[model samples]
Target: MGVAKKSIEEIVQAIGGKENINKASHCVTRLRFSLKDESVVDTETLEEVDLVKGSFSANGQYQVIIGQGTVDKAYKVLLEVTGLQESSKAEVKDEANEKLNPFQKLVKLLGDIFIPILPAIVTAGLLLGLNNILIGEGVFYDGKSVIDVHTQWKGFSEIVNLIANTAFTFLPGLIGWSAVKRFGGSPLLGIVLGLMLIHPNLMNANEALQQDVLPQWDLFGLGVNQIGYQGQVLPVLFAAWLLAFLEKWLRKIVPDSIQLLVVAPVALLVTGFAAFIFIGPVMLTVGTAVTDGVMAIFGNLGGAAGFIYAGINSLLVVTGMHHPFIALDLQLIAAVGMTYLWPVRVMSNIAQGSAALAMMFVTKKKTLKGTALTSSISAFLGVTEPAMFGINIRFKFPFVFAMIGAAFAGMIVAMNNVEGTIGIGGLPAFLNISPNFWSVYFLATVMAIVIPFILTLVYAKVKHKDL
Candidate 1:
C-alpha cells in the first residue's frame, strides 16, 4: 500500500492540499471534494496521479473519477491523508449546494434521482438485449431467429421479454420513489403516488394515445381524465416534486402529535388530484413535444447529428451534463421504438478506449503506460471517465483524435439509421444494437477503435516526438 498511499498523497497535494479541502465524499466512481478554493487546484498534476481517471469541477464540487472498486480505496486514503472524517454523500452535497447555480442544481438533482435507478435499468437492458437476440432475425439461423427456428424456446423468449420490459413499464414508480427521496419526502408515499398514476382502473398511457377519447370522471362539474402514466418521465418527475413539497410543508405546519395521521393521506389525496388534473397532462405534453422535437432534429440532420453528438460527448462528460440524456433515452424509447443516440454514445466510448490504448504504445513512461492500459480496458468495458479524463483529455491530442474517430463512427451510425436500447457502452454494448443492423454496426465499432488507435500513434510519432 506504500505506492498507493503515495499516489493518494499526490492527489491531495494536486488539489491544493488539505487546507483547500473543506469536505470530501465518494460516490460509486468519483471522489467529490467541497473545496475552499477550486482555482488553486492543479488540474494537470491531478490528472497525472496514478489512480485518478479524471478530474473536473461541476455541481459545486471538484470531482475526481477514480473508477469503481478503486475509488473507495482512494477515498479512504484521501480521508487518512487529509485528516478528515467521512461525510455522507448528502452532507457533502449540502456543503457544495451554495456554490451551484440554479441550472447546476437542477442537473445535480436529476443526476441524484436517476443514478440510483441505473442498476435496475441496466439489468433490464441486458435482459432486453438477450430477448432481442432470441426474437431478432438473422442472428442465429439463416433468415430466421433462434425462437423462430426452434419452437421450444418460444415460452422462454416471452418470459425474458416480460422481465426485460418491467422497468420501462413501471418506470414512473421507480422515478417517483427516487425523485421524492431526492426532494426530501417520504419515499413510501412517493411509491403510492406512482402506483396511483398507473392504477389498473385508469387507461394505460400508450393505449390512451391510440383512442380519440379518454374516459373521465366528473368532479366539481369538470371532467378529469382517468389516464395512467405508465412509461413517462416529465409527468412523474413533476408529480414527485409536488408530492415532496406538499408533504414537507404539511409536516412543518401540522402539530407533531397528529402529523403522521394527517400528513400522508392529505398530501397524497391533493397531489393525486393535482397530478391527474394539471401536472400529468401538462408535463406529458411537454415531454412528448421534447421527444418529438429531438427525433425530428436528428432525423433531419442524419449523419451530421451523430457527428456532433459524438464529437462533443467527452466534453459533456466533463461538465456532468450528460446525465440528462439517460432520461431522454428512456423518453425516446417510450415515444419511438428505439433510441438512436445510444449507439453513437457507444461508439464514443470505444473511440476513447482505443485512443487511450494508443498511449500505452507511444509513451515511454511506465506509470502512464500502466494507466493507459487499465483505463483503456475500463473504457472498452463501458466506462470512459478514466480514459477520457486520465489520459486522453490530459494529453490533449489523444482527446481530439478520439473525438475525430467517434465523429466518423457516429456518422456511420446515423447514415445507417442504427438504433439501440439503453445498456452499457463499449464492446459489450453491441448486444444492445438492433440485431438487423449488427453487421454494419460492427463495422462502425471497428472504425471507432482502429481509427483512434492508429491516428494517436501516428500523430505522436510524426508530430509530437517527445509525446
Candidate 2:
C-alpha cells in the first residue's frame, strides 16, 4: 500500500505546493487540504498523479480522493512532504469552517466531538451484541439464557456486561476528553472534569426522570437540580469546550507566577458550576427536542424518510458528512433498542457496489474495466469509497442509479417495518439482526444489489458502444 515517493511529491506539487496550504488532514478516504488560495491548484495535473483516484473542492478544502486501502500510506507521505502537522477530523473542521453554513458547522462540531470517542462506543456496542446472544431469550441458550443454565458463568457474564456498559455509563468523561482534545487543551484534565459531572454523589439524571425523584440543591440562592451526566452527550461536549476556552483565556491573563495552580482549579470550578446550572439543562432540553423531532419524522413518514435517507446516504459519505450519523444511529439504538438507519446503510453500500460492478462489465476500455472491478470488489466487502469516487461517481450515471436502488430498497424495508439491531451498519449487522426480520433484510439487500446493477449496466452498454 506504500505509495511511491515520486507520486507523493507529484500530488504535493499539483495542489499548489506546500506554501499554498493552510493545513492538511485525512479522513477515512481522502487527503483534505485547506489551501491558502484555491485558484493556484492545478486540478487537471493533480488528478493525473499516480495513486490519486480523484480530487475535488468541498467545504473550503481541496480533497484528494485516496482509497481506504492506501490512504494511510499516502496520508503519511503527504504529511512528511508538506510538513503539515497531523490533525484529527475535528481539528480540520475548525480549519475548514469558513465554507460551512452555521447549521453545517454545528453538525460538524457534533461529529468532531463524537468521532474521537466512537471507537469506545463501537467496541461497547459489539460487546453488547455478544452479550445479547448469550443472555437474550431463545438466542443461544436453547430457550434459556446461557447464565440461567450455567450459574457458574454468571460472574463471567457480569464482567462482560460491565465491560460492555462502561462507555455508555461514563459517556460524559469520554466526550469531555474528546472535546478538550479538539480544542487543543489537555485531554486528561478534560476527562477529570467530565468524570466530575457523573460523580456517584449526584442524583442519576435518567433514573431521577424515570422514577420522579430529582433531589434539588440550593446554591447561591438558586434551586439547582442534581443530574448525573452519564449517557448524556450535549452536557459533556459543552462543559469540555468551556473548560478549554476558559483555561486558554486564563492562561493568557493570569500572571505566570501563579498560573499553573490557579488556572486549572479556577477553570474547573467555574466551568463545572456553569455546566450544572446552565449548559446541562439547556443542552439536555435541546438534545431531547432534536431527537424527538427526528424520531417523529421517521415515525410518521416511515418509508418516505427511509427513502430520502438511504438515497442520499452515499452522497453524505462522499462529502464526509456521514460521520455525524454515527452518533445519531447509536442514540437511536439507545432509545429504541434498535435502529432503522443502519439497515438502510447496508442497502446503500450494496447499491454502490452494484453500480461499480455494472460499470466494470459494460466499459469498453479495458483499463477502466479493471479499475471498476477492483473498486466493486472492495465495495462488496463493505468498503464503498473505492466504488464511489474510484468508479461510480467518476462515471456519473452509475452514481445516480446507485442512489435510486438504495431509495427503492430503503422504502421496501420501511414498508415491511424492518428493524435493525444495534451494531456496525455494514456486514457485521447480520450478526445483530432482529428475529423474523432476516428474510426481509436479505430480500431488500438483494433488491438494492440487483436494481442498480441492471439499470447502470443497461446505460453503460449503450454508452460504451458509442464510446
Q: Using TM-score, give the best candidate's number.
A: 1
Candidate 2 regions exceeding 4 Å error are 1-31, 36-50, 66-104, 138-158, 211-213, 334-337, 364-370, 416-422
Local accuracy of candidate 1 as per-residue lDDT tens digits, 305-384: 99999888888777878889989998998777589999988888999999999999998888788889999999999989
Q: What is the C-alpha lDDT profile of model 2 across 367-431, one tens digit per residue?
A: 67777888877777667877887777766899999999999988877766676544554445555
lDDT at 160 for candidate 2? 84
Off by over 4 Å in 1: 3-10, 27-30, 47-54, 65-81
TM-score of each: 0.95, 0.83
